[model samples]
Target: MLRCPNCNTHDIGRVGTNQFYCWGCFIELTVNDGKISSIHQVEEDGSLSSLNDLFLGDGEQDSISL
Candidate 1:
């Protein structure tokens, strides 16, 4: 099961082919090759702000089995 790297919760919902939204932390996650490639925060204006640094750190990637 895919879990949110931010909230560590399993309350992630698929928003697209490889995109997922985390209800626990209100963040969007993009998966590639069964790994978390990017993360974003859903702003009130419906804009996305990158949260990769906060979650994955500088140039690092997190693994998540599809």
Candidate 2:
């Protein structure tokens, strides 16, 4: 029951063992130790643009539902 951190949608799919993709906002979220360690946005050309700086401002951790 993992949800997207950005869109807060339940439309998340597993792209890897610990990698998840959000169809709602087209963002990739990687979870490690129950916390979001990486966040990337899917570009039009299928490239990943790091959105971590925008969401992860300061030294704080964001947890996603698993």
Candidate 3:
């Protein structure tokens, strides 16, 4: 089970082929090659705000098993 990096919850829902939405923290997670490539916060206006800097470190993506 994939847990949200922000909330550490398993309440993740698939929004796309590799995109997932975290119900726990309301963040969006994008996966590539079985790793979390990007993370974004869904704004009230439905815009995506990058949260990669806060989660990923120095351009490094976090690894996760699908």
Candidate 4:
């Protein structure tokens, strides 16, 4: 099970390959090489804002190893 970096919620929904959606914070999660690399929040304008820095502990280094 994957955990949401933003809300620390384990309620993540798989949306695609290496991609997940966080129901807790409604953020888009993108995993790479078994690690979470990017986090985007869906804006009211239907745009995405990068929230990776806010969620990731060590930015790109917090990714999981496969």
Please report the candidate that would top TM-score against the real structure. 3
Per-residue lDDT value at 15 in model 4 = 88
Ranked by TM-score from best down, the candidates are 3, 1, 2, 4
Q: For candidate 1, write residues 1-66 as lDDT tens digits.
A: 898887899998999999999998899999999888899999999999998888888777887788
lDDT of 4 by residue, 1-66 (tens): 677766887888888988788788889878888877788998878799988667665644565532
Backbone clashes in model 3, listed as residue pairs? none
Question: In model 1, how large is the Cα lDDT of residue 17?
Answer: 98
1-66 per-residue lDDT for model 3 (tens digits): 798999999999999999999998899999999899999999999999999889998888778987
Is candidate 2 or 3 superior in TM-score? 3
Q: How many angstroms is residue 51 displaced in model 3 relative to the true structure, after the best TM-score fit?
A: 0.4
**lDDT per model, in order?**
0.90, 0.87, 0.93, 0.77
Q: After superposition, how far is residue 35 of candidate 2 from its true place, in Å?
A: 0.5
Model 3 per-residue lDDT at 1: 78
For each of the candidates, give the backbone clash count. 0, 0, 0, 2
Residue 38 in model 4: shift from native, Å?
Answer: 0.8
Candidate No. with top lDDT: 3
Off by over 4 Å in 1: none
TM-score, cand. 2 vs. native: 0.89
